[model samples]
Target: MKGFTLIELLVVVLIIGILSSVALPQYQKAVKKTRLMRLAPLIKAMADAEEAYYLANGQYTPFSSELDISWPDGTLAGAATDDGYLRFSDGTVVDLLSGSSYLTGSASAYVMGKTKEGIYYIHYLDHSSSPGVRSCKGDESLCKSFGGEAFNGGWKIP
Candidate 1:
């Protein structure tokens, strides 16, 4: 008599469950977006460094140290593997694509970052062509949710 009946308790539990189910996905999305946003600044810095290096040397270098930029903490500057990918301590993998003759430019470079959730972000810079091209490759809905435009079978980020 003092407490709620079984039916009333069950209803309360059901409502709580429903609310949680609705909120969980949104929380996860926010987490994912935050993770992606964290890498944006790093990508921009890398692009700037690559551009400066290209102007000085007339070519891009795959080595982060050669660019003369101050890398962020937890960045493994010496941890570049044979495939030219750098792994961060926070499970982010970055690959600097440089010195490729495929694009028409004095030098073309792209800094790609792959988050722990398997979302790939690419910041492409071409000195003679497009100065900045930001794109994301992953779940279409997720990409679009974070303000990505559909471009050439990929999501172009603003």
Candidate 2:
């Protein structure tokens, strides 16, 4: 009689539980989106560096060392390779898509990363066609959140 009834306390608890249930997933989604957003600028920087390198050398190189990129310490891991591919500490991979076709006129590169949930996000830069084209390849909803348009079984991020 001095305090709230059992039914009243039960209702309050249920309401709080419902609110938390709804909020938790949204919070998780926001965190994931933030992480993905951080990658975009980094990928774009690499693409710009690749373009500059190509202009000077007339061909793209896969190694980041050859490009005018000062990668942050701990950003990259593992030993260097001659194959023109680099791996980031976060498990993302950047590959310079170069070959005879590249020297013939088409020069391009791509950065690909996979989320813990097995979703793949890819950013592609094609100097021959569009110069800087970003693309995504998983979870249509997630891709659309990045302002992507569906194309060829994937989303082209704008």
Candidate 3:
């Protein structure tokens, strides 16, 4: 006799469901931000390895062979194609930057591209390629943030 009516119970359940739907996307975005941040350190590590290889060889070595040294400790949760020159994870392939010293100087070399399930980025290898000044031409805001003779930010790559 004290129990709530079926209509009241259903109304409560519907409210809860509505609340969850609104909150879910925010939670998902937070998760993505955290994941993206974790990748920051990994990116730095890769960059360090590339620099080490540069110091030892005078320039970037072959992208394939040099990748071993480029990411000397790379064991991230991704599939490394010939070391870490190319990293494929969660359906995304992140290619390290290189030049003729790497993959015949193809666009495949000289830049790193990150394509997430919903986002993408094209990273350049030098300041010369910064936005209006480089080969990247999709997102202007992202391009401007990317810089350095040795790096570019993780862009939304195609």
Give, for candidate 3, the lowest lDDT window spanning 10 residues: 126-135
RMSD for each of the candidates: 2.8, 3.4, 6.6
Worst-scoring 10-residue span by lDDT in model 2: 96-105
Could you give candidate 1's per-residue lDDT for residues 1-158 as a string of tens digits?
A: 49899999999999999999999998998888777778899888877887777777776775665765666665764554646567888788877764352233644457778888988877777663445888777667667876856864668888
**Model 1 spans > 4 angstroms off:** 75-83, 98-108
- Encode model 2's per-residue lDDT on 33-123: one tens digit a residue: 6666666776677677766777787766656567676666787776444566666777666555433223435543454555544455565
Which residue pairs clash in candidate 3? 98-110, 120-155, 120-156, 120-157, 121-155, 121-156, 121-157
TM-scores of the models, in the given order? 0.84, 0.74, 0.57
lDDT of 3 at 34: 49
The lDDT ranking, best first, is: 1, 2, 3
Off by over 4 Å in 3: 67-79, 83-92, 98-118, 121-158
Candidate 1 local accuracy as lDDT?
A: 0.73
Candidate 3, 1-158: lDDT as tens digits: 89999999999999999999999976876665444444444444554565456556655545544544433355335445554345544544455644342432234334443535434333333222342122333334433344433234333322
The best candidate in terms of TM-score: 1
lDDT scores in order: 0.73, 0.64, 0.47
- 2 or 3: which has the higher TM-score? 2
